[model samples]
Target: MYICLEGIDGSGKTTQIKLLESWIQKCGIDVLRVFEPTDNEVGKLIRKLLQNPDAINENFQITLALLFAADRTVLMRDITEAEALAKIVISDRSFYSSMVYQNDSEWIAEINKHAKQPDLVILLDINPETAVSRCDGMDSFEEQNFLASTAKKYLELADHQNFMVVNANNGINKVHDDIKRIVAHKLGMCI
Candidate 1:
């Protein structure tokens, strides 16, 4: 199973992923944890661009879209291998993020067409204000307006079947409990 956690910045993806990993491990499922904009050179370049305030323009979005596609292409082999080894691969982000973060959705989809789709995308939905408050406000994308736009895009992508939405406005444990129930239902595993 390929599953990914999606949300705006500071939506608790890191926290929830850690919890999910431990819980799934206790459930006897070996997991392969992968993160987007991986630690490769290309990903490093992308990170540098994101941190540069000058790169927060329209042109930057296009550049980031391309970089993200390249990064995902490079990561695909690892994902394939992990699945072959019967490990359930979980990712911090995926091609879906490009669609949310970039301006031209159609172009983002085209660039990411070669990327593998997640079997499940769990969106941790939260208000833009709440999300920005949790972030350090250092990155180019941590502003409330940008986050609100991205959050809306994420909700539009959520289909409630494979793309499940969980309210992240609640406390961590409550949100996690909701996610656990969703996972149990989808994977037929006991929580």
Candidate 2:
């Protein structure tokens, strides 16, 4: 099973993933946890660009989108091997993020054509204002306007069957319980 947790910055995806990993392990399932912008060569370049966004021009969006697709390709190779070993792969982000963050162009779609889709996409939904207040420093895409736009885009892409939107404004335990319920249902497990 390939599960993806996605949300804007400060939406508590990492925290929730950690909790989910522990629970999955308790169920005797081997879980492989991975995050985008991995430590590989292309991922390193993407991280560098993100940290130093000012060094790049407007063209960086296209470059970053392609880089993300490249990174996903690398990740999929590993995911395939893990799946062959019967491991459940959980990713922090996936191509859905690119669809939300990158330019709405055919090039972006074409580049991600070969990327693997998650069996379940859990979207931690939170208002941009609340999400912004939860974090300290801001990244290139963490600004108020950008996050609001991204959140809107994510909502647009969210589907009922494959996409599970959980309200993250609740307390951590409540939010985690909601996610657990959804994931359990998807996996046909009694939690």
TM-scores for all predictions: 0.92, 0.93
Tens digit per residue, CA lDDT, model 2, 1-191: 89999999899999999999998999999999999988899999999999874634667787888889999999999999999999989989898888887777577779999988899999999998888888987544538888898888888788633589999989899998999999899889998
What lDDT does the true structure give each of the candidates? 0.85, 0.88
What TM-score does candidate 1 reach? Answer: 0.92
User: What TM-score, to 2 decimals, does candidate 2 have?
Assistant: 0.93
> Under the 3 Å rule for N, CA and C atoms, how many clashes does model 2 have?
0
Q: Following a full C-alpha superposition, what root-mean-square deviation does model 2 have from the true structure? A: 2.2
Enumerate residue pairs that collide in model 1: none
Q: Give the clashing pairs for model 2.
A: none
- Evaluate model 2: give its lDDT: 0.88
Model 2 CA deviation exceeding 4 Å by range: 55-57, 139-142
Q: Candidate 1 local accuracy as lDDT?
A: 0.85
